[model samples]
Target: MAKILVVDDAKFMRMTLKNILTNGEHDVIGEASNGKEAVELYKELAPDLVTMDITMPEMNGMDALNEIVASSDDARVIMCSAMGQQKMVVEAIEQGAKDFIVKPFDEARVLEAVARVLR
Candidate 1:
């Protein structure tokens, strides 16, 4: 199972992702409420993957993805956002996000992204 870090400002969203990852047989090594925490946790945990929400307090997922990718060229991150954030999704891919998942999340899609990124 891949070690994953889940980053989202909303506690409920974090929990939902944690459940999904666990059910998919992945290990959730950490959860962060914002990009700042996500960056720090990523440095410490060195998880195999990260699921990052696009909008958050302190810093956004785009910035966090940049930071992580800057530090580790091979870092695998999947950007997550609600519907209608297509522009940001495209930007995220350009910034090095392995994939993007639109919320409310689908079980199959989330797992698919996770599996694909792990591979």
Candidate 2:
């Protein structure tokens, strides 16, 4: 089981993700409500994986992803975005996000993405 950090501005999204991951037998090491906090927590926690929201307050996920990757090339981030945010998703991929999950998340998809990245 990989240690994970979940980052999203929405409380429900964060909780839901936590539930899914924990139930899947992965360890959720931390959660953050915004991109800035996500980055800080990533450094402090040094989790094996991160689920990052594309749009967030303070700093955006792309920026955070880039920052994290710059600090640690091995940083594994899976971006979460809405259906219409294709451009942001592409940018996130360019910024070193290992994978992505769409909003209104599907459990299977979420688990698959996490598993793929962890593998």
Residues 1-119 of candidate 1: C-alpha lDDT, one tens digit per residue: 99999999999999999999999999999999999999999999999999999999999999999999999978999999999999999999999999999899999999999999888
Alpha carbon RMSD to native, model 1: 0.5
Superposed model 1: Cα runs more than 4 Å off: none
TM-score of each prediction: 0.99, 0.98
Tell me model 1's lDDT, rounded to 2 decimals. 0.96
Lowest-lDDT window of 10 residues in candidate 1? Answer: 110-119
Q: Which stretches of candidate 2 lie over 4 Å from their true place?
A: none
RMSD of candidates 1 onward, in order:
0.5, 0.6
lDDT by residue for model 2 over 1-119, one digit each (tens)? 89999999999999999999998999999999998999899999999999999888899888889989998978999999999999989888987899999989899999999999989
How many clashes would you count in candidate 2? Answer: 0
Error of 1 at 100 (Å): 0.7
